[model samples]
Target: MTDPALSELTPEQAQMAARVRRMMLIAGLTTGLGIAAVFVAIGYRLFRSEGSAPAADVTATLPRGARIVSTGIAGDRLLVTLEVGGATEIRAFDARSLKPAGRLRFAAEP
Candidate 1:
């Protein structure tokens, strides 16, 4: 079937329309490729852990009196809850190296 829109356009107008369509297609493909590259980079970074230690020695890194209550992973950080004396402490560490980043201690109830 003939396209009514194409039949209505002059020869010059048809050429311009074709050029615009081609430009839009190129632009869309470029945008898609850019987005795909970003996602691939993110995936590579997330999964790349070669040459690093198989496991982090978390227990050895804890304080002498601290006892691990729970453990979890958050983004790039490791979350470890410890019971130190009578206080509940949340220790945050670098997930890859197990290096201590910071700690949060809950105050004892009155």
Candidate 2:
């Protein structure tokens, strides 16, 4: 008996081969999409996560060597103390307006 491997295929056999080729193409595309999805997930995990500290919507950073020593509220008054250059300065502000009223400066040490 002759082998069938190298023989010319019939019409039905050719159609089956075409169908198999289409199925393999679809499978290849689906696998490629899945791999891309995995890569996206890994990228999101590696580069898009929250860092150590939460982000601030607004920030006001005082200059170096200046420290906010205290804060107080009296009725409609706001008081804040800034200690800088070995001196403590007291500042008064209008609480409602959030504007400076007056400040008393203390002499700094030599």
**What lDDT would candidate 2 get against the real structure?**
0.80
Q: Which residue pairs collide, candidate 1?
A: none
Best by lDDT: 1
Q: Model 2: residues >4 Å from true position, as ranges?
A: 1-6, 54-110
| RMSD list, candidates in order | 6.9, 14.9
lDDT of 2 by residue, 1-110 (tens): 77887687889999999999999999999999999999999999989875555433433345589899999997777888898777888778766566678787799567
lDDT of each: 0.87, 0.80
The best candidate in terms of TM-score? 1
Kindly report which residue pairs in candidate 2 clash with one another: none
TM-score to true structure, per model: 0.49, 0.41
